[model samples]
Target: MPHSFALQRSSVHSTAFRRLAWGLLVASWACALVSIGLSLARWAAIGHAMDWGRWLPVTVVPAQAMVAGVVAPATMDTAWRWLGVALECIPGLALLYTVLCVHRICRAFLRGEVFGPEVVRGFRGVGWGFLAMFVASLVYQVGVSALLSWLASGQKAGMVVLGVSSFEMSVVVVGLMMLLLAHVLAEGSRLKAESDAFV
Candidate 1:
């Protein structure tokens, strides 16, 4: 029957899409994991150097003055300043992959596919990823602040600036908490939909 053939084709297409979405998710997570690992290794190397008193504070005054004088006036070298644009693309692409996965999961749930557990697991994984990154960032910032304070004793103005900048650690923590909350909401919605169908 033509109807039966069409149904089989649709099912195959759905399976293929699911496979593609899962592949994207796995690849994205792997990239993030590798990036985090590399970052940790770099941090350890830097910390070891600092511990041996092999670190010297770079005089950023000249660089700051030059930027303020020329870059601020023309704003022409913005593209040049953004040389790390490719590195920045990693996170952007990973987040886009997550969004696509979430959308796919949502669509599956709407079709009564019962992917609730998968969605919950995926959400938890994302939440944990965010939390780990947040904690690592906080640790790095705190260590840097302590080192700077030790190196620049009696520089009250510099210490105050560094202390204020360190408050970004709190922002990271809050952002991770929000990400966890988002996962919870998404999982809860899927659960609710299933429950309503049973009712």
Candidate 2:
């Protein structure tokens, strides 16, 4: 009965939303810090890195053909390594953006600004962030493939690989769903304003 009572208390806006606000703020910052630390570690490892190509998306040649004297070690150096690291970090950055938007919405709820313009905008921002994640993933795959390919064989332009996986398609669906939610919130806000004016 006590557990059920706590569950029931969660239905109250102020209690639940304040909890969510603080929880998300803490978790988001923690994950963002971890991600940055990992990225820095990877960047620093670029110098003495073997099997680094295993961390990257593989660049396939047509028919898996290998020209004689082609570079086989699969290495990235100089500006290429920086680009690779930046590409790897982009998805994390996108996720951070989404969390930031969620944090904003949570803050609004904590302040009793439920269904306010800030929350609506935050939802839209998160929707765009999800879409940005999908886009960034595509760019990462393509860019890494191209970089690896060019480093392998200068004459080969065989990096035209393109395919959509379940995760990519799933994020698109989620992004659209978030956008729909934002639209619904906008409509609800309109109705609320109308009712308030009527009152």
Question: TM-score for each prediction?
Answer: 0.37, 0.71
lDDT of 2 by residue, 92-167 (tens): 7898898889888877877766666898999899899999989977776666556556666653653533457788
Question: Weakest 10 consecutive residues, lDDT, candidate 2?
Answer: 61-70
> In model 1, what are the clashing residue pairs, if there are any?
none
Q: Which runs of model 1 end up more than 4 angstroms from their true locations? A: 1-16, 43-114, 128-132, 148-199
lDDT of 1: 0.45
User: Per-residue CA lDDT of candidate 1, range 48-136, in tens?
Assistant: 22333556632221121222231111121333223223333444444444444555555554454543556555555455544444444
Root-mean-square deviation of every model: 12.7, 7.1
